[model samples]
Target: MVDADQTFVIVGGGLAGAKAAEALRAEGFTGRVILICDERDHPYARPALSKGYLLGKEERESVFVHEPAWYARNDIELHLGQTVVAIDRAAKSVRYGDDGTVVHYDKLLLATGAEPRRLDIPGTGLAGVHHLRRLAHAERLKGMLTALGRDNGHLVIAGAGWIGLEVAAAAREYGAEVTVVEPAESPLHGVLGPELGNVYAELHREHGVRFHFGARLTEIVGQDGMVLAARTDDGEEHPAHDVLAAIGAAPRTSLAEAAGLEIADRAHGGGIAVDERLRTSDPDIHAAGDVASFPHALFGTRLRVEHWANALNGGPAAARAMLGKEVLYDRVPYFFSDQYDVGMEYSGWAPPGSYDQVVLRGDAGKRQFIAFWLKEGRVLAGMNVNVWDVTGPIQDLIRRGTPVDTEALADPRVPLGELAGRD
Candidate 1:
């Protein structure tokens, strides 16, 4: 049980940290909750930055998880824009970045999210080359979008993952001519596999987005200290006014490692290792969100998820665990993305080669379908593309671990709810 007098410190001010703070208060713990964030603003929905926020469809205030006033009303202390340099586990304190504002905590939660992976190529440090990970990045990209639209600037993207594709959609919406170069044969080839990825490639092609597949970015050429073009290994130079690197993100785990916490290896996605209850090596310390490599109960494998849903749910679980509660953290992994006219929601993990076949209901070409990845007739994961209101049923199917009839799943006449007995 918590002492009800000691302070609870949460690092990383993203959704996970915010939710953890909320969970502590909601659980009737009268202890002090201090949320330390590197970002200047309060917690906000990061996924919106790629879509509504980036497109100017949502106001800046609407992006926040809770307004600045809400934190004070809830008696939660906000330490905004404080960069944490180190964690002294023995001292039960955190050292601030260079400025030296040290804070103490009885129980610590590391939610120190991830950082965008940088390209090793030359000229990447040029003025117009950028990577998106925070609100600052979005704001810069938004400003660039405005400039690009007015000047008809060319935007070159170095990846075709969710980030790259979403940015491409938003940039195109802003009237920037976009070109995406990927080392893979199609967009999201690593995630959705080649067949489904091809469908996305077709979607992008229809929207006047050009893709250079099987091309490796060799250099970011610049002139006058600003980006000019992206040169690939195939001896082709694609002209660009700006370049966005959407390769991937690396989990921020230096502090955890420094504090002697167990960390997973690179092959395991290299994150702070946590048990089923989200507890780290130290009994008094816990970790969640993007930095946590947790043993997923459902999949029976250690995995670290960077998606919003993981942070949203994992935060509360970690907080409860800290308070001596039963914490399983067995949520079926879920994530959604919007690109052009296609909207998709996927539940459960479909690790590479785990699913033998992909079964589809409706039409992939029409951008209306529910794709199911099956392992020996047991549904491993399901994705709904341009289809709405079926996430509950899809998640339930995964939790039940029941073998499904492929014929029924492929039949649109059959209701999705009937397929999942749990939901």
Candidate 2:
């Protein structure tokens, strides 16, 4: 049992770590809580970095998870701008910052999160090459976008994933010319497949966002340390004042790997491996959020989700597990995106080849539709674009894992909750 003398250390100042600290206190744990973050800013949600904040629609303070005074009021030690250099598992302590200060923990939670995959090509170090991952990156990009918009500059973005697409939308809204280059055949091809991916392509195209499919960005052409254009393997050079590398993110697992903690393989979305209860190989240590790869009972697969919802929910779940409570962290994989005028919420894991058929409901042309990925008639994942209030029912169907009539599933009249047998 955890006592007042025991200290719980949480590494990472993202949503997962912040929520875990909040959970620990809410769970009646009187132990000392220390949250260590490498970033100088307080724990903040990242979705706004590409959406509202990037668009200048939301205030800077709105992104923080808690007020500055909340941490002190709750007696939670906040270590900002401090990086944990090493984890001495044998000593149940972590060495952090340049001074190598040591903090002992009876229990530890690793929520180091993920970092944007950097471009390995030439000219990546140019002045106008950017990647959005942290608050600082967003702040810089936001100012750049405003300047780019005022100057009517062209922005070439690599990758058509969520981040890239969202940034593209924001750039277009800023009145900047945006071009997205993706190796895939369509936007979000890996997630929505060609059928629904086409919808996003059309949506963005209508908003003056250009798409360059079936090519990978090979180099960022620059002059005098400033980006000039982006060159793809297709032998095409797209003029660009700025280039945003939104290829993807890799889980930050170096600390865990160096500490000899079990790491998940690339096939399982590589990260620190954890069980259903979020415990790592070492019983005293737990991992959560974008840094944790855990078994999903519902999907019958190991998953490492890097979405906002995962971090929001995973932290508390890991905290409960750390408190010795029975925790089966089987939440459906979820993520949402706001691009142009289309807002979407996706639930469950249904990567390409995992689902055989995609059933669509409502109208795709109108950008109001629900696309369901099914395997042998069983719902594996669902995404609602410009649709509302059906996430719970969609997740329920995925959890049921039972075959459903595709016709009923596609029928807008047939309630999703009825198909899931929730009623």
Top candidate by lDDT: 2
Per-residue alpha-carbon lDDT of candidate 1 for residues 1-423, written as tens digits (9 for 90 to 100): 687688999999999999999999999889889899998888987998898899999898888888789899999989998888888988999888557989899999999999999999999889999899999999999999999988999999999999999999998888899999999888988678876899889888888899999997999998889989999999999999999999999999989988899998886788999999999999889999999999876777888999999999999999999899999988888899988778999888886577898899999889999999888888888999989999998888888786889999899998888888743
Candidate 1 ranges with C-alpha deviation above 4 Å: none
Instruction: Give the range of the ten consecutive residues with the poorest summed lDDT in model 1.
Output: 414-423
Worst 10 residues of 2 by lDDT: 189-198
In order of appearance, the predictions have TM-scores of: 0.98, 0.99
Model 2 per-residue lDDT tens digits across residues 203-319: 899999999999989999899899889999989999999999999999999999999999999999999999999999999999999999999988888999999999999999999
State how far residue 45 of model 2 sits from its true place (Å).
Answer: 0.6
> How far is 238's C-alpha from truth in model 1 (Å)?
0.2
What Cα-based lDDT does every candidate model obtain?
Answer: 0.90, 0.94
